[model samples]
Target: MSLGDENDGGQTRTRLPDGGTGDVYGGARRPARNSRSLITVVGVVVLLIAAIAFANRSGTGEGTSDDTAKGPGAGAPTSATGVRPVTGKDGTIPTGYAHDEQGAQSAAANYAVALGSDGMFKRDTRHTIVRAVHDPAVVDSLLASLDQAYSGTFLKNVGLNEDGSSPEGLTFVSRTVPVGTKVTGFEGDTATIEVWCTGLVGLAGEGSNKPVTETWFTITQKLKWTQSDWKIQSSSQQEGPTPVNGDNRASTADEIAGAVAGYGGFTYAR
Candidate 1:
C-alpha cells in the first residue's frame, strides 16, 4: 500500500542493489520454465547491444546531487510496496511517478523493469508491454527493432517451444532490478534519466544449460509526460559499473523452478 515518492504521489522505491540495478516483471503466467539457459542468451544480447548511459557517478540531472547519499529526497512521495507476483493497473506500468525530473528517474526505473521482464520474450505480450511503456510516437520504432531482435528462431533456441511456450515443464524467467535512478537533466515534461540495473535470467527446469546468471546494465531514457503519463521517448542501454558475482551456492534446478511458480512480481514506483 506504500511505495512512491511522498511529495510526488506514492510510487515505487528503488531496490538499490550492490553496484546499482533494479527490475520487475510478469510472474503469474507460466507454460513450463527455465533459468540457467537464460544466462547465455541474456549475456550475448547485452554484449552486442547499442551503448548508452543512464545514472552514474558522473551523471548529470535531478537526482539528489548531494553525492548519491541514501534514500529518496526529503520531499519524496511514499515507500516501497513490498508486494510480489504484482498485477493490475500499477502492475501494467509505473504509477505515482513524479511529473518532473524525479518523474524521469521513475520512468527510467519502470522502463528498466519493463524491458527486462518475461513480457519481452513473447511476441504479443512484448508488443503490448512496449506500447505501454514507450511514448506512442516511438512505440512503433522500439517495437520494430525489438521484433527483429527477438526473432522466431531466437525464441526457440532460448527454450521457448515455439509459440512462446516454455518446454513441457519449465518456466521462463526474465527479471531486471533497478539499483537506483539519477536524473541527469530536466526541462519541462521532457527529461533524461539513467536507471542502473542488475538482471536475473534463465529457465528453471531440469537439464537446463543456461543456469541463471546475473548481469549489470544501465538504461538511459529520454522521457516525456505524454497524455498525462511518463512515456519513454527513446531509450538505450549499456554495460555497467558491474561488480563480481557472489559465491553463494546457486539454487538447485528444482528450487529455482518452484520459486518462479510460487512467488510473484510487483508494480514499481519512485
Candidate 2:
C-alpha cells in the first residue's frame, strides 16, 4: 500500500507476511537490524574522521606542523603582515615605507587615502597633499590639475564655500578608506599599485540638498622611488567593485556630522 494511504480512523497501516520475516518484495529475508545500524554508524564515523582530517590540514588542529598546514596560498586578501606600520609621517600622511613590495603597496594605499580626503577639496591642504605625495617632477602639474578640478564652481555645487568650507550648520564629508592593495608591477625603482577604496562625500545637514553618500572605486598609482620614499608619478581612478547596500537604517545628518568630527582617519599600511 502507498505510504500516504490512511485507514478510516486516520491511522496508517502496512500489510506484512504472517511471520513478519519477509522483505516487502516477498520471500527474501531482510538484513539484520544490527547490521544496518552498524553500517550507518560506520558511515557517520567515516564522515567525522574526514572532517577532522580536513580541519587538521587547514591548521586548526593541535600537533599539525605549521609549515605543511599553512602556506602562502592560505592567506586572505586582507591578511596582516605583522610588520609594524611606518613610523615616519609627512604632516599627517604616513611615510618611510620599506624599499620593497610591501613598502610600495603601503605608500600607494596611503596616497590614495590622502588624495581622496576632504583636504583635496581645499586649496592649501590640497597643495600640501599633492606636493607631499607626488614626485617633484609631477608636483607642479598635479597641483595645477587639482586646483582646476576643485574650482569655486565645483565647491559651490557641492555645498561648500569658495574656500572649501561647509556652510553654517553643515558638514562636508569626503573620506576614502582603502579596502585592499595590490602591486601590479614592481621593478627596481618603480611600482604600479592598485588600491580598492570606498569613499564618503557630500554635505551633511538638515535641509541639505546633497546628503552624504558612499562610492566605491579603485585607484591605480604609478609610483617612483625617490628621496628615500615612494612617491606618486601618476594616478587614475575608476568606479567600483561596488557591493550591495545593507539593510541598516540611515542616520540623521547631525549624526553623520558628529561622527565625522569624532572619528579620525587612519594612516594605512600593508
Candidate 3:
C-alpha cells in the first residue's frame, strides 16, 4: 500500500497520509438544524420503500434473481474447505497456492489483504511483501519506486515520522478487510481477479487531527502461476461500491486504538 500504482501516479488509498486534516467525513461540522424533522421524513420514506420492495418481490417470478449483483460475501462459508489452508509461506506471505481457479482466487485475496495492511508502511515488511507477492520481473523496480513514494515528505503528509513510524503518543491504524473476490478472467496459467475491500486508515489518539476513518475500494490483480504459486504481474485499484454512512455512534480514539490492539487481524483465505 505504501507503493502507489506504477500504471497511474495517484496516491495509494491505504497509504495516503492524512495530515491532521480532521475528520474528512465532516465529523467536526455540525448540522445547521436538528435532525428530528429529517428523521421523521426518513421514517416515512423507509415504510414506503419497504412497501415497494415487497410489491416488486411479489411480482417477480422468484424471490431472487440471478441477474442481481453479487454483494460482499468474502467471509461467508460457501461450504467447508476440504483441503487444508496453505502451510507454506514465502517470508510472511502464503505460498504454494494451488494451481487452479480456487488457488488463484485464494492468492489474490490474501495479497490484497497484505498490501492494504498497515505493515506496508514499514521498510522491511514492505520489501518482504513486494518480493513475495509481486512477480519476480517487477519486484526490483517496485521496491525502488515504493521506497521513493514512502519518502520523508510523503510520511509527513500522512502524519507519520520521517521513517514511517507513528509519533510517540499516537497509535497509527491501517487495515484492509476483503469483502469478496471473483475472477474476471482466467486461463490455465494466468488469472485476473477483483477483490472488494473495506479499509481503515489514520491515527487513533485523543485530540488526533486524523481520526480513524474508513473507505471502500476494489483491487484488481493480474496473477501468473509462477513457481507453483500465484504472483501478481500487475495490479490497479479504483474507488468502490461504497455504501452510505450509517448513524452509528463514533467511538473515542482510545476505544478505537484499544480494540485494534486487542483484536488481531486474520490471514485471509478464500
Candidate number achieving the greatest TM-score relative to the actual structure: 3
Candidate 1 on 18-124: residue-level lDDT in tens? 21121112232222222321223332222212222122221233434433323323222223322121222444765445455544565566666776677777778
- Estimate TM-scores for all models: 0.67, 0.70, 0.74
Off by over 4 Å in 1: 1-91
Off-target runs (Cα >4 Å) in candidate 3 are: 1-82
Residues 78-131 of candidate 2: C-alpha lDDT, one tens digit per residue = 554424567778999878777766667778777767766777777889788778
1 or 2, greater by TM-score: 2
lDDT of 3 by residue, 1-270 (tens): 212233543333332333444443333432222222111211111110110000000011233323221332233233323144666777666677767655666787777667766677788887887788878987887777777666787666667898879987788887777666666777789877666677777787766676677666677677898877788877766656677777666776677778878988766543
Error in Å for residue 173 of model 3: 1.1
User: Total clashing residue pairs per candidate?
Assistant: 52, 0, 1
RMSD (Å) per prediction: 11.8, 26.4, 12.5
